[model samples]
Target: MMYHHLSDAMLDDYLRDVPVPVGLVARLKQTAVPNDAELDELLRSPPMPDGLVDRLQAAIQDEILDESLRQTKVPEKLLVRLRTIPRARRRSAWRRFAVAASLLVVLFSAYCGSLSALLAAMRPKQNRDTTLTIIELYVDPTHSSLLTMSEADPTTIRFAPPTSAEMAELPIELARLDLTPALGPAGHLLQEVRRGAPLTEDVFLMRRNTLGSPQTNDQALPELSHVRRRQIAGVDLPLAPGYDRAFFLKSGIHPPVFPAAGQPTEAIQVPLVTRTDSVDLTRRLLLEGRTPSPSDIRVEDYIAAVRYGLQASNDQSLVLYATAGPSIFGRQPHHMLHLGVKAPRVQTATSTHMSIVVDVSASMRGDDRIGAVHRAFEIVLRHLGPNDSLSFVAVNHEIVRQVDFLPASGAAQLASMIRDLDPSGGDNLAKGFQAAMSLAFEAEVAAGSARHVVLITDGQAAIGDRDAARMRDLVATGETFSIRSTFLQLDRLISAETVPSSTGLEHASAVSPRQLPWRLVTLATGQSPVVARQARLQVAFNPQAVLAYRLFGRGPTAVTGLADVGVETDLHSGEEASALFELWLRPNGTEDVGWAEVHWTDPATGSPLTTERMSIGRSDIAVSDDETLWPLRAVAIVSEVGQRLSGIGDFELLNGRRFSQRKKPAGWKDVLEQAVGVHPSAGEQSDFQQMVDLIRQLEELALRGPK
Candidate 1:
């Protein structure tokens, strides 16, 4: 029962401590005081703890027939609940009446909420002007495992409980481009560079390329600069991060943008901005939930697909995280990286053209390994325009011509090369890579383009003990030629090929142990840096359950010893990027969980930067799965939590199933719908109404299919 609305005199008396349970008096205090007769009657005697109010209400009910309750009896349990209230007295009929009245009031409030459209119709009209706020972030792709949710009405929001039909699936619906676009120039709107802000309140200023059209090679994108200030989905868009903005943008025009892969938003061109001005430490309002705090609307964010293990052992202890650094409005990096740390000096006599050499050994002939390489090579060729050139070669028992450091051609020739690949032979990874590097160096000298070598291999060099030395030789060659070597592994079957891989992994830490063999070809030939540089992350935490936490393998990644801490991800050799870490915290003594900070470097120039801080308090909830989600987070959480609870081993989730958004709800649908229903409509009809609406929707819901 609400105590604040009680009669002022009675409330003051209750706070002052007159022993509770004065039935008539308590009822008089909790209910509206009738006229002079009622007032005089209450003054005659202190009300008893029972009977009086019920009798009075019953008498009123008997006299007035219009508003009789179908079930008017008040139970002891409700009255008992009221007794502990600081302002409430002991259990009594009077307390029961008060409880009944409170319930009635709540029903009426809900009734009002259901008629929001009618109330809105009666209220003054909005300016009809809609402003779109743009947001963006950087992401590392090697280690990330994000999936995209295609259904659940990105256009119109519905008020319903999350059902099995609404859950999102993994690996299948997991579109890396859906949230944060893969490393391409198309999402440049959110991919613009960011400079750090002092990050106190609404003080940080986010700036971008502010384009009106697509940006292409050597050409600046068109610009539309007047900032529009309208709240999207109950969230205010100002110059602010994810909260309310300071000004109103011109009305009626929709912001241009699209929900980036692994990011938020669906509009095109015009960027979307979020609420929080910058990062925060103490607040737990960053991620989404049914009950949002002021801080939740202030930032735009989503949970990461991969759950880091507690102490890097098990994936339990999920933490909620908010958008910060470059990840807020754009795609961010999946893995934490640092490059050029101890890069040897290059004594190049001339600038070299970019080139990559691949290994088409027998080990990679099967299972589309060669196919993946061909696809990557094709994408890279397309990425290059007039002024650029590349040279490609395939190494087997003998070096074979793929592109041969020649100028790229129209799509036809590239396709023929890709389709002609035939893989089979003894593994000679070292020679293949060496020949590729030498060819890349020679191509650079001939064409005057940046030089690089990409090595794709499934096994270590077949030379046994000399394998390590051979790999080292490849790295040294890249250094000597001022070219960077990007090593990509296809399948994990090469675990036995130890020496060559170990040496290469040590030098090219950015390489992924599980990428398709083709990606290596792209990396070696691509111009973007292989890793981000000079990155840092700072996290402020809710003093609740966060007694201590540790970052695994990453340097000093633990925060237990320090009062406050900042984390960083850096080292860029290819294109620039950042990442978001959702840290669901379990507060002490309270099931309410909170999250930590995720920050990174400016992709343009490795510089320290922070994102709008997001914190989600503890929760003891076990969300039911949504069939529509196809077990995205549901599976992620299950795997992480299962590993945590069972102390089992870690495994990568691979999706062999695909579900359509139009398909009937079954598994993932149940997961997503459950989360969607947890959050009240709050009268939000559009996803953009509250920029955090969708993220909140995601936070409230998680889905995983049968293991």
Candidate 2:
């Protein structure tokens, strides 16, 4: 079994033919072979060319299959079936794969193109620039009642016929008194009389004589001769003797002053009088002729007669005090009503549910107006806290709920929507209010939240109910729902022509045409027109050199430099500032009499600051009954007169003649006398007495001629 040195071919043939003894195999098993380093190196080396091993394996497999076939016969039918199978089908599969790959490539290219187009479509479109104009109508709810008149009927009277002799003498009597110098060119003798200047004795005598007699040169006036007196208010009363002269004098006379055919007459300057002044003069003349009945005066006339004193409340609120006096026009009792409103202060911690309803109607399309609204929204958003909830409703002909009631997280989305908004269509304030109310109701349901709806519009409701009463009702509806509503009317200060040239792509430009070089664009556009000057500069300077500046009635101690300081620096919340200027006495010198002012913008609210002025001569202060109360009294007078003349009050009298002889209520002088008799406080009594004395002095001055 372990034959040594046997030839390799002989040992292989002997092992194949006969099995080796078990003892010999065991001995071979136990024997250890030496390590063949050369053989390991040969194995690690490349056996042959890359495909040589595969080729060798295929050849070996074929040889083995051939040997097996030689040793064992295969079925002829199976071998024939295997050989008949088609091999070309593999080429078909390859072709299908190539077609699928080409299809995928085409689909991918199309997909990429479609995706690019979609992205482009999502972008904002650029449109042409549109110019817009806005007009705001502010209806004060508190003052609406003033638009109506009382139900009481006015008294009427009739005069008796006059004789022919009186008519004949009227012309001669009128000619004796020349009214040219007193009436000036405008025929406003009452205005001169109201100025309270002393009149000349001759002028008084002329007026007395002209009003006392109806005959002159032994002839009766024509007015007396043609006596056709009509009854008023169904009351027929006999005329007093010589009533023609009184009537003629009370009713102003117009005498023609003709110019030569070729000669030009010089223009005459006439002093302007406000409606209040006219009413006052008319009332005074009626009193001088006869007493007015109680029903003839109006509530507004009564209110206008009192002088309201200004006082600041403890909480920095304003308190207006009006001295109660009898009606100046009729016999109406007077009472005082004081109202105070709390100022809005910033509260960062409070949770607010705010619904902003903006009018994006055609009227608000103006860049300045709408732009102001946008800025206001920004300011409001900035003031909102994290706990605050917001809802935005934009209205034109239709209502758009741009943002629903949600937390401050939606602020960014709301702002984006606002920027994209462009004014179009008509205003539907009612629909806007409804949408806002819905939001407010939603906000109300949330616990611990205060609801408010801010309506920012041009105040024109064209597509909806434009009636003021209906609008007020809508506001009342909001109140019922427990939602507080505030209205802001956007008023544009600068005209469209004032704006710089605007290209269609102004929106894309870095700066807007509406923007001035020095300040933000919206500051000047959004604020009240009165503060335009201040919004731009943040400061205003006085151009004139005045001896003194006084904020009258506020006292010299209230502000520093009562006389020297001209510029006003403190202006907040768009409040207006007015000052009385003391100028150097320039008797006959010709110089500009106006005061100069500069205004600037407020950084906090983006509103404008305003400075106003009034010139006061030394004589005015000297002639005033109470110098300390002069400014307040003057302000009260202006306010009262303005209120009455605004047409919201005393509608019936607005169109009446300046010197109507119609009877009116007793003068405020009588009312003051009664009030004084009531034994008011010493201060009140003094003020009342001073007012009475002032009125008497005015009457005396009117009767007498100017010195």
Candidate 3:
């Protein structure tokens, strides 16, 4: 029988009183002992700190208790042996110190491995690893109240000296980074941060969720969580940027207070915009193992992102759908009214002239923004026919590349052009738009071919035409040539006036990269035609039937008797636009709840076509579980989740001095069980499910103090 050979260390152990096999005995003869010179050199080294072995062993013991450490695949037997090493060896001081130093190195390497695992697990599955520079602020030990910023990755980050306001408390000096040439315009972002702008929440959360220190559990937040933020101040202390009202208001300016009893009729001007960014932002935050900021939750966007089973119209008119159900939300029982409208489908067989302008600026480098633009055009290219013409333009500081009116037959060439896009330099989106419009007019449209310019950008126009007036002018020029402009906003924040006065039926939609292909398909193929231009919905609640009412998604800019505000919204074929209202119903009142009106115009004649109205009745209200009431139930479910995260519309009796918990709303479990949920079964359904689950998990995590 053959015996396995032992290692040198094991052989040393075996030779000390233990019997060794013949195979190990032969290997032991080859092993060498420390020479006289090596022994002297080891002795000459400086003495180790007193209790160094004990401290390291204690640290390892505490590290084992961390959640990250518990989840790691470290060998239990090895850890147990390491813990007992000091007691097992009755050795000299220098030898114990040497052993402990070696163990410290091993522990550090293990920690790095665990940290990489933790970050990888938090990143989205579809995204590649992105390099990010994190700037951390820690309280100085000598001066507990003072904070200091650490040096970030030198290539990507830079800091100017603190401004007078920033140094009010202490200098808080930070090391200035040397920004490389490749960083380009990104270097300005650090100045924005130093000026008290809110830093990206991802950076903040990434640091907050990293592995705990091995030496101590002295974290900034209260309680003793294994995942702790060492850079944060105390519990009541504000963030480093000093969050103000403007910072919170960026989420959205709260709508005017709900109309009081005996008030005039309320009307909301539904703007022509698609609000999907907030939903995308909230989901991305949750996917990264971070609780979304309350301000990031916009209930209106959640309502707009999903479908409500609205069907297409047969004629050139509006199809109105309305439903009423008793709501389970709020301090008092209320009624939920769901108002929906769908525009009739228009078949356009004419060839389309398409112009695609892509932003290849430095700010668009992260988050795969350029990749999304590429994918959008790929979808558009697939939808076009041989006769259809395509124009591709890329912009950064100046026009990077422009291929004018490439026939669909040359799609391979266009694809190659788009794939070569690389993000760099400044953003001059206005120049790109001008070039695209010039190309569109230079080529005469064949008889009835449609003209469309699709501008894909993150909306950070740094160099030129940053104001609304210039963009409005560009939109007007596009209107002259009957060119429809569609701005695909790819950022988390959507400005209210991306293309200010879009009278020429210009459109804007906030969408994620994953959603870009489908959105582009709808635009490129005219799958959903615009049946209504400058359309608006007016819902007047009966004062006798309802004591107070609040409109979800949009709040009335002003409330007067009637016709107070004028807003234009575009209604598309096979697309559903819905508004949810929470009405405080008056007991012992009339049966009539409210009435809604849909006003729209003809797409060709620019004349008002017809008005549609539906009268809501209180007597026909059903419970949420009713199969026929799914549309209204969906509005309730999505609105409630948004309110729970945002704390908006919740009554605060004590005005922020005290807090209390009321009964939670019901039917979430039932909603999940229903076949029809927030998104369809294709790919979005799974994402919606994951988002809901993450919300629940985050709520539980909040309740369980620090773990």
Candidate 4:
């Protein structure tokens, strides 16, 4: 019998099959890779082909082939063949068919045997392939006296590092990584090395719940069971540029911080990297403290941007790479985070006052910005109390329309004007805000109430008699007149006021709560006292090798140990904020493992906010097989697959590629349903289902990827 066979790898890559994550299944020309193992076997099996088979799916075609067909006169032909064949020959023919099936099985597995089964055999009989890492991080209270408050004031991470002797003594199994001090304000981020097949992998943050508490046989944060294939806007980043001392700056900034003890603190220049235009990168980062620019770059572009783009443009000077590698966020908080106002902070029906300036510019015709704006308006309208008055303006060159939702005198006229606000010649947002200020002033005059001017724009501008100073003057005067001018900034604008029409971070806005909705976020969350305003972390141990740590929180800036920051400043408004900090610890040796102290202090207040200490005990915490499915592993895999297949980078990363996350899947809605155990809102059940789908997708990807 003739048999056809193929390897799992060949079938996976060439057959248009990719390993995809579980839940997200939208194949928008940009998503791929994830199918089950047993299911994969069916996919790999060769089938008899026919005209009907060519048109239908493999499974359906199989069913059609298996079904009896034609006039049922099969016995006559079978009887003739049976008579021709000797009884012994007939039995022999059956053995030949069995042998052929065995041959096909061997051929299929010649190269693509099961990875799990092979690894299972190599492992010690008593040992499970999976393992978990648990670390007790703490500091020696007496160590404080050893360093002295003055001596310990960190100018750099190099002043001291964790030692090795104590590390070797820990009771838990651990994978150690190199530790280094961070420069300037950001504190040390702890990184750890995890062994993997494709490359030497590592983790930056760790679990807070597992550290320094009771140990129920504490486990290491899960490792990635397998590598993921991600496509981020189809951009590929080269390793050398980021790790091999390269700097690419499409844009950057220079800040001045003085030195201590008569020492001159040299100016440090930081570069911004991007595949999109430098201006877009700069503007987005400066305003939102995020890489809001679409990631349309190749890994190579990332390398080049890090290497040559960062140098002084004219000189092609290579900037210095910091001790640690690239930040989780490439460029620091220097971009616009606000995509736009996502509705007013409150939709309560309380008596309130608000104003909105819409971007009805001809340019806004088909962008998502308009839809987003409509969404914001809807959310804000929900919070307007009976006593509150909300106003609206559709701006194009000038105030195209205005709606007074309160006074009841001009509501209908305003609505008609709004409906008729067709996209027009240009955007004059400054003028729109001025008019809004005038209206607010008039409203305040008419009735005593809190006055606020909410300016909405793409942050773009078309001049008609205005400048920054002029705009600032209006804002200042309006504020002095007791009217608060809150900017619902949408996009960044470039004009003669900008440098050579260059779009870079050089001229970013220096405002708190950089974007619009954030203002509401701060206001709303501030009402809750439990919302953390400041935190302090104190860590200690081997004071030799470097240690770097980062806190995953929302805000414009990261609080580093070097910065003498007080934790008095409040975080944006929210009932609670949660983050999982991954730490890569590089213990000099097992001997160096011991207790590390972490004290979290606020930036606004020097006093300690949280004084948490964890003591680590070392055992045999080796990286395990279970990590192959950690949620983030799935995310990274999905990212690679998406990027490789389609260039969907911009909003996908921010939205997490629609993969339902466990910790904070979407927002409060998710938190209430999961952690708080509240019933899901109507669509939330679907969200959880989506997460399950993603998990299945991940398993598929793992099974399908090349060994």
Best by TM-score: 3
**Model 3, 1-707: lDDT tens per residue?**
22257777876776797665778865776466666888899898979889999999999988878867776555546889878856464669999899999999999999999999999999976523233333446833333232333233223322233332342222333578888675444466566667887544446534655333212222222212122111110011112221122322343333222333443334334443334455655544443455556644556667766566667666667777888777655564556778777665444467888887888877676555775676457546756766778888998888999998898788768876776777777777778888887887876678867888878877555433354557668788878878887887784333234453222224666665645655665656666445688777767766677655555644222222113334566665445577777666667879987777877788777898656567888776664444336567666766666666665654322221122235444324443333244334322332244445645655555555324
Residues 187-264 of candidate 4 have per-residue lDDT tens digits of 222222122222112222223342333222222222112222221211111222111111112211011111112221
- Residue-wise lDDT of candidate 2 within 98-128, one digit each (tens)? 9999999999999999999999999987543
Flag regions of model 4 displaced more than 4 Å: 1-352, 363-389, 397-425, 428-431, 438-449, 458-460, 466-481, 486-514, 519-570, 575-605, 611-707
Q: Any idea how many clashes model 4 has?
A: 159
TM-score of 1: 0.29
Against the true structure, whose lDDT is highest? 3
lDDT score for candidate 3 against the true structure: 0.59
- Cα-based lDDT for every prediction: 0.38, 0.39, 0.59, 0.35
Clash count for each candidate, listed in order shown: 169, 31, 0, 159
Sort every candidate by lDDT, greatest first.
3, 2, 1, 4
Candidates ranked by TM-score: 3, 1, 4, 2
RMSD of each: 35.6, 45.7, 36.2, 39.7
Error of 2 at 437 (Å): 0.5
Backbone clash total for model 2 is 31
Task: Identify the runs in model 3 with alpha carbons over 4 angstroms from their true place.
Answer: 1-263, 266-273, 350-523, 526-530, 553-566, 572-574, 649-707
- Residue 482 in model 2: shift from native, Å? 2.5
The lowest-lDDT stretch of 10 consecutive residues in candidate 4 is 335-344
